[model samples]
Target: MSEKKTINDAVSKRYEHGFVSDVAADTFAPGLNEDVIRRLSAVKNEPEFMLNWRLKAYRKWCTMKMKTWASLNIEPIDYQAISYYSAPKTQDGPKSLDEVDPELLRTYDRLGIPLYEQKMLAGVAVDAVFDSVSIATTFKDKLKEAGVIFCSFSEALQEHPELVEKYMGTVIPVGDNFFACLNSAVFTDGSFVYVPRGVKCPMELSTYFRINAANTGQFERTLIIAEPGASVSYLEGCTAPMRDENQLHAAVVELVALPDSNIKYSTVQNWYPGDENGKGGIYNFVTKRAVAHERAKVSWTQIETGSAITWKYPSVTLRGDDSVGEFYSVALTSNCQQADTGTKMIHLGKRTKSTIISKGISAMKGQNNYRGRVKVGPMAEGARNYTQCDSLLLSDTCGAHTFPYVDVANATAKVEHEASTSKIADEQLFYLGQRGIREEEAVSLVVNGFCREVFDQLPMEFAVEAQKLLEISLEDSIG
Candidate 1:
C-alpha cells in the first residue's frame, strides 16, 4: 500500500554468498578445558584478576547444561571438537592504515565495510575482531579526548581494572542463562565501550567480526556502559566463510544505560547459511540485553539474514521512571534455515514505555517464529507497550508463527499487540514485470519494501549495504 513497500516488493529476491576468499588462517587446536581457557587468557596477556574471573566462569560452565527447549532440532554440540581461538597470521598489529595488512583491508572491502583507517584515524573509531583476537583499534586517542574508553575487553580489564571489575556481569549476571554461562567462561575476544558522564562520544563506535578458521566456534562478549547523561551508538557486523560442517557461534552482549544516559546498539549479521539441504552453516545462538536505569533509554536494531539455526532474543529492562526501550528487527530464514527470535520488555518504573517491531521472511522450507514478552510490574503505574510482528512466506514449504506473553499486574498499564502472516502476491510480481523489471529484481524490490520499517532504523551507510546483502543472499529463492 505504501510507496516504500512497492520498492521493497521489487527487492525480495533470494541471496547467496558473493565473495569467497582464499586467505590462510592462524588457529589453535580444537578443544575445551582449563588449559585451553588459561592459554587463551595468557595469549591476551590478561591481568591476574581477569584470569581469576574467567576461571570462575569456566568452573560454573562446567557444571551447566546445554539448553534444548527451542523448537529447533539440532544435533548435540561437541565442545571438544571446536577450536577455541583463531586469527590471521599474515597481519601484525598496525597503528595506522599504512601499517595494516593490505589483504585484510581487501577482505573488509569485499564485506562492504568502510575500513579506511585514515577516516578512523581522523575521527571514527573501530575495534576489528578477527576470529578470537582484536587485530587493531583505531581512533583511541580521539575517544580518550572525550573521556570515552573504547578498546578490547581484555585490554579494558588490564588498563581499567576497577571499571571492569565493577561492571562486568553486572547487567547480565554470569548465571543468567545457559549460552551466557558458556560465553562468560570461554569468550575469547570482544569490544568494551564506556562513555564518561555528561559526555557524548565524538564518533561512532563499531566492531567488525569475521570467522575464518574451520571447526572453530566464535564466542565473543561485548559490554557497554553509558554513565549519567552520556550517549553512544555502537554497531556490529558478522561474516564467516562457506563450510559444510555446522559451526557454533554463541555470543553475549550487555548494555547498561545509567540515569539520564542513552545507548543505541545495532547489528547486521551475515553468517554463512547452509545450502538448500542444510548441510553446512553456522548455528547462531545469542543472548543480548540492555538495562535502562532511572530516566535512561536504550534502543536495539538488528538485521538478521544468516545461520542455519538462529535462536536469539534481545531484551530491555526499564527501571527508570519515564525511561523508554525500543526494538526493531528484520529476520529472514530461507532454504532449510530456522530462526526463533524476538524481544522482551519489562516495565518496572512509572510511565515506562516500550515498542517492538519484528518482520520475518520465510522461503523454501524455512521456519520462522517470533516469541516475545511484555511485563508490567505491580509498581509500574501508567506503563505502556506496543508490539507489531508480521511474517511473509515465499512458498507453501515455509512456515511462520508468533507467540507473545503479556503480564500486566497494574490496571493502569496499556498494552497492544498485532500479528499477521502473508505471502507475496502473483499480481504484484506481474505488475512489476509489466513495467520491464526482471523477475528477480522485482522480487528484491518487494521484499525490501516489506523490510523498510526495520531497515530504516539502521545507520545510513549500513542500511543501504544491508538492503543489498539481503538482495544478494536471497537470489536463488526469488523465482
Candidate 2:
C-alpha cells in the first residue's frame, strides 16, 4: 500500500474501548418516576434521609426543562426511555478481588486498568465503577491507615454516613441545573474521598467509569473533601462500549478544600465517540465544581478526546481569603464530535486569584467551543484572574469558537483575557515532511506541541496517554 493509504487506514481506526463484555446484569426498566428513585435508593440500602433527598430532587426535575446551550445542536432526549440503573448481577458488594466477577475483572484489564492490588499501579488507589456500581477498590487498607477515606460513593454512604450527609450537596446543590439535577435523583455509583486534618494522602486516588450495559444511562456522583492542612490528588478515567444508539452520561462532582488545604483533580475521558457519521457515541453532560477556603487551592486539569457531545464546565469558588483556583484543559473533537467545555472562576474572598488555560483542537467535521466565566464579588478586594483560550483546527471543514464572560464588582479586582484561533500552517508541515515525517505523524507532532502546556498539568503517566489519544483523534483530518 502507498504511504497515504497506510495513513488513511490508521486514521480510520475503530474506537479501542468499544467492545462489550458478556456479563449478566440487573437493569431497571426504561422509565423515570418517583418509584424508580425509591427503588434505586433501596437497592443500595441507602439511609432514609438520602431517599428523601432524591425525592425532593426528582420533584424539582419534573418542573424543570432541558437547557439549550449556545452554538450546540443536540437532538431531543427521551428521559423516560433510559434505564436509570444497571449493575452486574451480584448478591452483595464484593469483599475482595476473588469475589468479584471474572468477566468484569477481565474487562477492566482490557481497558488498561488492573484492579488487583498487586498487579495495579503502585502509589495509586483505584475505585473501579462498572456500569452503575463500584466493583472494586484497591489500596483501601493503606488509605485507611493514613486517615484517608477512599471508596465508592455507596460504600462511603454506608461507612461514613455523617461525612456524606454533612457535605454531599453543600457545594453543588441538588438543583444546580438540568443535567446535575437529573443526576441527583438517579445517580447510581461513583467515587468519594475524604482526607483528615493535617494529613496528606499517601497515594493518588482514582476512579475509572465504564459504561457496559445497553440502554442504561450512567449517572454517577463524586464528592471529595480535604480538611484543614490536608492535601490530595485525584484522577478519573471513563470509557464506553460502542453501539448504534447514543447513550447519556450525566455525572456530578463536588470538591471542598478547607483552610490551607490543596486538591488537584484530573480527568482523561475516552468515551466512545461514534463513527464518522455520528451514529453512536455518548452525550456527556457533567457538572464539576470545587470550593477553596482560606489559603486553600483547587486545580482542575482534563484531557477530553471522546464523547459525541461534551458539555461540562469544571468550576471553582475561591470563597476565603487568599484562596487560589486554576483550570487547565485540552479538549479535542474529531469525526463529527461537538464539544462545549470550559471552566468558571468565582472569586468571593479578598485577594483571591485564578488562572485558566484552555486549548481546543478540532479535526474533520468536529465543532469545538470554549465558553468560560470569571466573576469577582464585591468583597474580593485585590482579586485577580487571567484567562487564555486558544483553538487549533486541522481541516477547513472543522470550526473553533470561544465565548468568555467576565464580571468584576470590585474596582480593585484585575482580570485579563486573551484568545486566538489558528490552523496547522503549511510551512510548518512542509518542514516536518522534509525530514521524512509522514503527513499524519507530522500533524500529530504539531497537535501534541500545541497541547503540551495543559498536558504538563496532568500526572506523568496520564500526560503520555493524553498525547496518544490526541494523535488517534486527529485521524482522517489530513489528506
Candidate 3:
C-alpha cells in the first residue's frame, strides 16, 4: 500500500501536452446551419456531389436525438456555441514540412511527432492535422511508386473523388447514428489511404491530430480501402491543450477490406481530461467500423487514457465467407473521467469468426463501462466468437460495469464470454515492494502484467508507447 500511494503520486501530474499554441487562425462563427455546411464545402472546394451529401447528412442530424442510453454521464452540448471550422491562415497552404509555418512545425516537434522527411525513410509515413486542416504529409512520392494513395482526406476528395464517392458511407451510413451524421455534415479534414490490389504497403501509414484552437469542434473523417490481396497497417494519435471549458470532438473512421486483404488499425488517444474537479476536458464521441469481404480480415487495437467523457464502439462486419474480425482494447479512466466503450461483431457469411478482448481500469471517481454485442446471422453457419472483459479498480470510489449481448441465429454457431473484476490489494503492493523494485516500476509492472494479452496484439512501436501511457495515466490515482 505504501508503494501504491507513492506510484499514484507519480502519475497524478498534469497532462504532458496541455500547452496551447498561439497562431493566426481563420475560424467560422459559433453556429451551425445549412449555410455553415455549404460554406465549409466551398472552403474545401468539394465537388457538387459532396456538397449534396453533407446537406443530406445535416437534414438527417437535425431530426435525430442524441442517444444517452450508455453508462456515461455527459452534460448537454450546445452546438450553437461551437465554431464549426478553424484553420491556420497559411499562405497557399504549405506542401511539405519545410514550407509549413514555423509555429505549426514547432507545435508538432514539441509534441514529439516526427514531421521531418528523414523520418519517412525509417518506415513511417505521417499526415499531420492541425485544428481543422492537414498541414503536412510525408513520403507521398515513395508511396506513389507502389500504387498506394496516402494523403489527407481533402487530397483524396480532389484527386480521387471517384474512389472516395464509391466507399464513403458504405460501411457506416450517415443515418447509422446521431454523432456520425453530425460528423458527415461538418467534418473538415482527416487521413485517407488506398492500397492497390496485390500490393503490400511499403511502410506504416500514420496520422496525428492536434486540437489547438479553443471552442472549436474537430470533425475529421478517415477512410481506408485495401484492394483484393492487398494489406496495410495504420496508426492514429491525438492530443489537446488544457482549457477551462469542455471541447467537443466528433469523428468518424471507416475501413473496407476486399477479398483476401487485411487491415490493421491502431489508436493511442490522449485527449485532455478535466482537472480533479472535472471542470474542463473533451467530449469524445466517435464511430469506427470496418467491413471484411471474402477471406479478408480486419483488426482494431486501441488504448484510450484521456477525455472527460468518451462514448465509442469500434465495430466490424463479416460480409463474406471465412472472413475474420478482431477487437482488442485497453481503456483507463482516472479522476473524474467517464468512459463507455467496446465493440460489435456481426457475422453474416459462412464460417465467420471474431475475437474480442477488453481491459478497463478505473481510479478515483472515474467510471468505466464495457458494452459489447455479437450476432451470428442465419446464413452464418459454423460461426464462432470469443469475448473476454476484465476490469481493475484502484479506488473504492470508482466504478466498473460490463454488459455483453450475444445472438446466434444458427444452431451451428458458437459464442462464449468471460468477465472478471479485481482491486489492487495491499498485499500485492507489499509483495512487489519487498522485491526492491521502485514504486513506479512496480505499478507499471502490475498494470502491464494485467494488460499483456491486449498489448501482444499491438505493433512493436505502439506496444511500448501504450505501456508507457498506462503507467503515466495511473500515476496520480493513489496519492
Candidate 4:
C-alpha cells in the first residue's frame, strides 16, 4: 500500500462513545423566551437572585448578534429549534449508584466511568452529568468532612445559595460576551466546588458530562472558589453519542482564587465530532475565565480533540499584586473538524506574571486556529508575560492560523511572544520508511514530540489518553 493509504487506514476509527441510551427522556420543547427562562429556573427551584440574574442576561442576549469575529465559518443556528433541557426520565438526582437507572449505569460503564463502588478511586471525587442534569455527586460526605464543598450547581444553589450567588458570575460577569450571556440565561446543570481556607483539596475533583437526548443543547455552568491560603485541582471531561443532526452546546465556567490561594483546572473534551464528511456533531462554544487575588495563582490545562466545531478560550486575570496565571493547551482537529482555541491573560496589578503555551494539530481537511491576547494595564508596573504557540499539519489540505494580540500600557512591563508552524516533512517520512518504521508509527513519533511541551503539563491520566487520541485522529489523514 502507498504511504497515504497506510496513514489513511490508521486514522479511520469510529467515535467510540457514540452509542445512545434507549431510556425515555424528559425534554423541554424547543424555543427560547422570558417564559422559558422563568420555567427553567422554577424547575431548578433557584433563589430569586438567580432568577433576576438570568432575566437580565436573557434580556441582554436578545439584543445581541452571533459573534463572527472568529475565523471559523459556522452554519446558521435556530435557537428555537433546540431543546433547552433534557434529562433521563428520573425526576430527581440519583442518591447513589443503586438509584441510577440501569441504562444510565450501562452507559457509564461503556464510557469507562469509574462508578463502581469497589473500583472507585480513593482520592478522586466525581460529579456525573447526563444530558442537562447532574445524575450523581460521589464522595459528598468525604468532601464535607474535610470542610470542602463539592456538588452539582443545582445542589449548590439550594444548599449554599450565598456562596453560589456570590461567586457564580464574579469571574466572568453576566454580560461578558454573546455565548456567555446565553449560558447564564439558560444553563441547566454543572459542577460547583469551594475549597475552604488553609486547606488543600484532599483529592482531585472531577465532572463528566454525557450528552444523550437528541437535538438538545447542553448549557452547563461551572463555578469554583478557593478561599485564601487554600488550593484545589479540578478536572472536567465530556463526550456525546453519535447523531445525524448537529447539536449546540454553550457553557460557561468561572474560577476565583482568593489571596494566597491556588486553583488548577484541567479539561479533556472528546465530544463526538461529526462523521468524516462532517455530517453530524456538536457545536461547542464555551467561555472560561479565572481571577487571582493578591499573591494567588490560577492555571488551566486542556486537551481538545473532538466536536465538529469547537470555540473556547480559557483565560486568566491577574488582579492582585504578585498574582500568577498560566495556560497550557493541546488542540487537535481531524476529518473535517474546525477548532479555534487558545487563552488570554490580563495583568492589572503590580508585579503580576502570566505564561501561555499552546499546540495545535490539524489533519485531513480540518482547520485549526490559535488566537490569544495579553494585556498589561497602566498600573501593572513590573508585570511579565510570555506566550508560545505552535501548529502541526498532517495533510496538505489542512490549514493552521495564529493571531496574537499584545497590549502594554506600562513601559515597565515586559512581554515575549513566539509562534511556529510546520508540517510532516516527506524526507522525515522517507527516512522512517527506509528504517522499517511504518507510516502510522512515524507520524505518531513526530506528532508526539511536537506536543511534548504541552503534554508535560497535563495530569498523568489525561496525558496518555491525549496521546492515544492524537494517534487516532491523525492515523488516516496523513495516508
lDDT of each candidate versus the true structure: 0.83, 0.91, 0.90, 0.89
lDDT of 1 by residue, 299-342 (tens): 99999988889999999999989999999999988778899999
Query: Candidate 4, residue 246: CA error in Å?
Result: 1.2
lDDT of 2 at 352: 100
> Model 4: per-residue lDDT, tens digit, 1-479?
66555544555567889998997888899999999999999988999999999999999999989889898879899999998988888757677878888888788888888776567666788899999999878888889988999999999999999999888888898888999999999999999999999989988898999999988999999999999999999999899999999999899999999999999999999999999888899999999999999999999998888899999999999999999999998888888899998888999999999999999988878899999999999999999999999998777778899999999999999999999998878788789889998777887777788889877877666678778876744434552
- How would you encode candidate 3's per-residue C-alpha lDDT over 259-364 as one tens digit per residue? 9999999999999998889889999999999999999999999898888998889999999999999999999888899999999999998999999999998887
Rank by lDDT, highest first. Answer: 2, 3, 4, 1
**Best-first order by TM-score:** 3, 2, 4, 1
Q: Each prediction's TM-score against the native?
A: 0.92, 0.97, 0.97, 0.96
Q: Candidate 1, which ten residues in sequence have the lowest lDDT sum?
A: 3-12
lDDT of 2 by residue, 310-380 (tens): 99999999999999999999998878899999999999999999999999988778899999999999999
Of 1 and 2, which scores higher on lDDT? 2
Whole-structure CA lDDT of model 4: 0.89
Clash-forming residue pairs, model 4: 4-479, 8-476, 11-475, 11-476, 274-280
> Model 2, residue 223: what's the lDDT?
97
Candidate 3 regions with alpha-carbon error over 4 angstroms: 1-4, 119-121, 473-479
The candidate 4 region of ten consecutive residues with least summed lDDT is: 470-479
- In candidate 2, clashing pairs total 0
Give the candidate number with the greatest lDDT.
2
Better of 2 and 3 by TM-score: 3
